[model samples]
Target: MVFTLEQHDSSKYRRKARMISIAMAGQLVIFGMLFSMLLTSTFGNSLWFYALGIVLGLLATSALFAVLRERPWMAEMRYVWQLRQHLSQISGFLPTLRGAVEEDNRAALDIVTFYHAGVAQLATLNGRTPPEDAAWLAEAKYLAEKREALGLPARVERFDSQDLQAFKRS
Candidate 1:
């Protein structure tokens, strides 16, 4: 199944991307100010002090970026950004992917597999159904089996609240 770009809301993804960009910029500015102030107070108005302040400000910004990169929301933002990028190039990528699939290209198949996984993950996060959930699942299963056949240990896990309740009952 061909997944068109229109199925997902690009506006929402664009907003999330903007929010993350703004947040990162705000963090960098705040950290830079704090570091500059601390450095200025420690060493009066010397040239060396100014150089150290700049260095420290950069380090502070890097630290904040490192910390934020580990956050779940940041990860979600990254995924949204990736989805947006792919959607923008879908017109070209989709046809190439289809051609590759027809030619049995492993790399293309891998890309498709991960694309479906990402779509499913995005849908679940937004509490919506993917445009082709069943097709995605079928493709996922096929890829898992294919990987296993090639001596790769691939497993797919499905979670159901009712299944957990049944286990608890026993």
Candidate 2:
């Protein structure tokens, strides 16, 4: 089966985020275990030692939770969802493109625009169009090029999906 560029890009990104999250979880567990052992090792020496361990553990756990919430990996996962939604929109619109309906043509352009916007957002997160994103990027480019060749005006822009939280957009 042939995969579209958008699917290729988004799936690679989702896979990368999944790998990182798994690695981070593993590291957290290892660190917690090691720190617990070190903290409890001096249990008989002083009560303050145990107290320090509690404080340190609490601080570490809190920090870990905060990181997991705000890290780029979390954002990447959210992007994966958005990308999938955009893909579905495109797929749904594709069948109508051959018809002589203005509305359908507009709908198709809108779907392509959303797909490109997703690409831009993913690019911002990665600081570059990721190599994995190349496929989708190429597809978007090819489609846009085709639209241009047909004398159609197409414009696309990217915005942070998280910003739409005001209307519960996420």
Candidate 3:
């Protein structure tokens, strides 16, 4: 699915994310205690049992986080999180994307446009603006022109997340 931009409260989102993270940490601690007791009762308090209980607690907490993260209250936080993840994923393969662009690969060009657009969207969402002459802005402009030269749109605001995988093949 393509992602669309929606304004959000950066401070509120950060606060909510921090609160959720703290809650998850508390869940882990409580589970750790409970698991430790249960395992001690069943396994005679061995040191290995304590370690295993912690591992189990971590798994449980992770599962709980996955479920909670899908709830409606997490919408803003989730969107920002997903955007951050998409940005991170592309960064790892950027050299590849740039390389493909050098070859005039249309798909690469589209992906790059999407990438820069995504960055700009995130920055705007976070209530910050880059200077006109910033390196990122200049680079984004250059890429947009390349896309425009090929009779394509200057920038893409919505694109499929799966398009990121194209870099892997590059």
For each candidate in the order shown, give its overall lDDT on alpha carbons. 0.57, 0.55, 0.79
Error of 2 at 147 (Å): 4.8
lDDT of 3 at 25: 89
Ranking by lDDT: 3, 1, 2
Per-residue error at 19 for model 2, in Å? 4.1
Question: Candidate 3: TM-score?
Answer: 0.75
Model 1 gets an lDDT of 0.57
**TM-score against truth, every candidate:** 0.40, 0.34, 0.75
CA lDDT, candidate 2, residue 152 = 68
**Model 1 ranges off by over 4 Å:** 1-8, 80-170
User: In order, what is each prediction's RMSD in angstroms?
Assistant: 13.2, 10.9, 3.4
Runs in model 3 deviating more than 4 A are 100-106, 120-137, 144-154, 162-170
Tens digits of per-residue lDDT for model 3 on 1-170? 56665667877876787888899889999898889889999879799888888889999999988888889999988898888887787788788888888788887787778778777767766667743567777778778778878889776666566776767765
Q: List the residue pairs that clash in candidate 2.
A: 5-135, 5-136, 6-136
- Indicate the residue-level lDDT of 84 in model 3: 80
lDDT of 3 at 29: 93
Determine which window of 10 residues in candidate 1 has minimal summed lDDT.
Answer: 156-165
In the range 1-170, model 2's lDDT, one tens digit per residue, is: 11222323556665777687777666666666556668678565455665665566667866776677667646656555566665554444444532412343544454455556655655645557643567666767766776686676665443333322222321
